[model samples]
Target: MSEKSKNEPFGDLMKSMNQFFHEKPVKNILQSMDDFFKNPFPNSASFHVELKEKDENYVITAELPGINREQIQLDVINNYVKITVKQLNIFTTEDENQQITKKQQSFQQSTRTVPLPHHINEKKVKATYENGLLTIKVPKEKGKRISLDGNE
Candidate 1:
């Protein structure tokens, strides 16, 4: 028997089996597992951002180390506050010519959006960063409820 004719049937068999094993979901799950094992902490660059209601105000706390004071920004909307930590360039490498052989290395640039549980006075919001921790306080607005009459 010739080699071409002997291998033709096996090639066709592989083509049919390929479709079953190369499905999108199967490929995605395999890739996810591979990434999980390679990098156990995939989101190590992101810091912790927590929000809670306290003392009639909503307090937002974040843990950020080695971050400069100028690298933080806060934006407040109607009921949402977004905290953005700009890229912190911790170090850089240069060559003999001092031409920046390698660009700056930044640990992370992350943003966290938080929705206030209660109506808050955004104008009175205050933020303070100290000891590598950022804290923001948002005062709550007063609320009044009117009695609903039982009328069909």
Candidate 2:
């Protein structure tokens, strides 16, 4: 084949891509993605969490802004910690005659679970939430040391 044949395929590919990008559907999809990323909270299920080990305890700090303590739930099961947040929004519009014009209700819930390398004492776990920050302290379970020496 001639060199022109090889270059023609690449040129055609580029042209097709250029046209695809200009299409309305592709443009809308791209715009939607851009708008989604532009918002800090794209979905209700997203939050930031930090987990660290400090002084024989696992400390977990989660950032849950605009949420109240009543809407948050914490659980520790099988060495896994689960944090759940549920939010409910209600909006109502009333007309001049004291009649309800429009009523809207929305509920959003998100859960985040984290696993720890060591076992934690579920009964001794402590959690506190203040100012949109949730702090959980899980105490590590004590393990008995086994000696390797052979004995009767």
Candidate 3:
């Protein structure tokens, strides 16, 4: 038999099997599995941001552990706020009594950017870090309206 005909039988079986089950249902099952594995660790070393709005300003707090103040950058462009933090792994060797041991391992550096609820004055922004928590105070733009009318 020719090579083409030799594989025709298997191909036909596969086609029949595919026709047996609806493609959409099968695809949904596979997609659900993919999403489950995509975020294996949902809360591992991930920073959580909390925004509190007051009469005159917004207080933004982020839990950033193992990050130094010098490694963070904050910027406000147009109406969006961006914050980038970088952390470096530090290794140390210590001697206990008379034995010396070396330990080596590092965590991956990650960056996250969040959009603010309203426009903020970048010049008046204040940031402070204490006990692995970063607190930022952004004075809300006084004249700017939080919503725009249909006219413009």
Candidate 4:
């Protein structure tokens, strides 16, 4: 009976019914679902690393927690040192009914590739893990020592 909606299909009656149900708009609902999937999920990111030059050697340190030595890997490819780490998380929940639920998740690895200032001696490289920290030592290639005495 409203004059504003007098020519509308099913007119004022449908408008009043819509207000009663208080249904959410389609766009708003879709946006909320979109935001839910965009965040609140675990992801893989690079680990923090520190590189230092020690005379004829390069010292690399990385912070790795909640992981074992077996899960870590290192490789020298080209002129870069590739460091990879794999991590696994276990979650458990229980209620008052003495029921238990366990969930295991395998996350993507965190890696870092560092290039050395000079060519490294692959045979003399060394790495060690201690207290959640990974340390690597890369020795530089020895240069030929030439004596300048005007001697052929």
lDDT of 4 by residue, 1-152 (tens): 56655668676688777775556785577677787787634354667899998877889999987679998999987678989997766676777886786556757677799998666667789999999999999987777999788657
Clashing pairs in 3: none
What is the lDDT for 62 in model 4?
Answer: 93
Candidate 3: deviation at residue 150, Å? Answer: 19
Clashes of 4: 0
Residues 1-152, model 1: lDDT tens digits: 78986869687678878886689998788889999998888866677899888767888999988887888988987788888888755576789988777676656668888888655566799999999999999988777988888976
Per-model TM values vs. the true structure: 0.60, 0.71, 0.53, 0.58
Structure candidate 1, residue pairs in collision: none
Model 3 misplaced regions, further than 4 Å: 1-45, 90-107, 144-152
Instruction: Rank all candidate structures by their lDDT, best first, as comma-separated numbers.
Output: 2, 1, 4, 3
| Best candidate according to TM-score | 2
Runs of candidate 2 with Cα error greater than 4 angstroms are 1-41
Candidate with top lDDT is 2
RMSD of each: 9.3, 4.8, 10.3, 11.8
Name the 10 consecutive residues with the lowest summed lDDT in model 3: 107-116
As for candidate 2, its clashing pairs are none
Ordering by TM-score: 2, 1, 4, 3
